[model samples]
Target: MELQQMRYVVAVAETNSFTRAAERCMVVQSALSHQIARLERELGARLFERTSRRVRLTPAGAAFLPAARQCLDAAERAAAEVAAAVGEVRGRLNVGLIPTVAAVDIPSALRDFRRAYPNVRIGLRVGASEELVEQVREGAVEVAFLGLPTTSRPHGVAAHELAHDRLVAVVAPGHPLAGETAVDLHRLSFEVFVDLPAGTAGRVQSDLAFSAAGLSRDVAFEVTNADFLARLVGQGLGIAMLPAAYVRQLSGVTTIEVTDAPARVEYVIWSRAGRTPAATAFLALLDVPAT
Candidate 1:
């Protein structure tokens, strides 16, 4: 019924404890419970199953939760839209990006964004390119920065190409291949490697290159973080191939040019349906034209 009541319900459902929910919502336990009870009477369905130890959402509560969240999001968007019309941006900006993002410096960009729109709250999520893309399409993330193989493009979203570059080999200082100025995929494939997990966009670039060259490399370690992968390579665990720009920022590893390396394209993606004002402002900051 009331937005405040819905907020309390969502808070309780998420925390799974009336006491914690009350603390989170900054309301007394009795007050929150009373409001929820009043809401239940109005809706004619109990929204939660409370026990001595824990609280769980009832079937009806589960069904109502999603709609309640949507309502809250819509209301926030409406208020943000009005603010935007008056030349002020105020909204939550949820951004997702791959861990190896290089086209834009995320921390610096966020610093500038915060200074420009202090009222807008910013949230960041780091993930693989595929996961970030899906989050953008699903509206879980308002914008995402992705890096995919040159042969691949993000599907089901509006995207702007940022940059493309070939991957370079990264090896420990004492590794045999570390002294090489440049190497072909076939030559590199002979060595054990540390790489991102199989099927991830980051790993696929090297995999595709090796497969095309009719060579295969053993991935002795698979890690989600690029820094960790580089550390593994630095420790002589294995070698890795990563974006040229990204590799430059790492220490304790030697970077070699790859003559026949796979290239990756960086893209900034957003929902095709529409853009939130905060998202539009952030994209504008990056010089992305309106689409």
Candidate 2:
């Protein structure tokens, strides 16, 4: 029988009258009678003894009472547990990050998030910015960090601007252009530029900036990873552009300002499928409090 049927059985047994039980259960007496009749039919036994003036339980009804009560108690407790899990600060919190962010920016933020959400299971996936954005939109990830130019943040998605990351030119110390305070766009024409492969967000940002400057910058090498770019610069392969704050923090790479380039902003993204407490709490951790 159904849980509600067991509940109806218990109510009738305790009150010893179907009319009283149905009223207490907020159902019509006839409906309650039908439910009990169906339940008894299924059980192949009598659950109550009816009389002209009153009603009482049969031996079978008395025998079934404890099971019905325990079932109701167990169901209530299970429902409460599920609610508690949802409302409390504990669950798997899936997050996405671009590889550049995972290496250059998120190390400290990740450590702090883990400490803040010790009970939360944090899963981190690193990929290109384009992949990260798609993952957030599809609900494969709860939050992400990406460099913006996202004219549209896709349908049902929300964004939070984190920081304006300055772009710097990374070069090996021995490169001819390394000692300058900053280089104008023309100096770049003399250098071998490491390109972020076509179709990536980083590549788009780089192209848009150069195009705005009325210069067609050439790509000497195309690579996906900025951390690797830093290493290439350190090893004297080419002079390239990268996020100043991130690349400067690494040793053996000289970061020089690139004149008049737009600042890169990191955005934290989430979509319409509401965030869990674990995800919300982690978002707070990633948020840099405003001045």
How does each model score on lDDT?
0.93, 0.73
Most lDDT-accurate candidate? 1
Model 1, 211-284: lDDT tens per residue?
Answer: 88888889989999999989999999998999998888999999999999899999999999999999999999
Can you tell me which runs of candidate 2 are displaced by over 4 Å? Answer: 1-87, 102-105, 150-156, 287-291
The digit string of per-residue lDDT tens for model 2 on 213-245 reads 788776878887777867777888787777666
Q: Residue pairs in steric clash, candidate 1?
A: none
> How many clashes (backbone N, Cα, C below 3 Å) per candidate?
0, 0
Q: Deviation in angstroms for 183 in model 2?
A: 0.8
Best by TM-score: 1
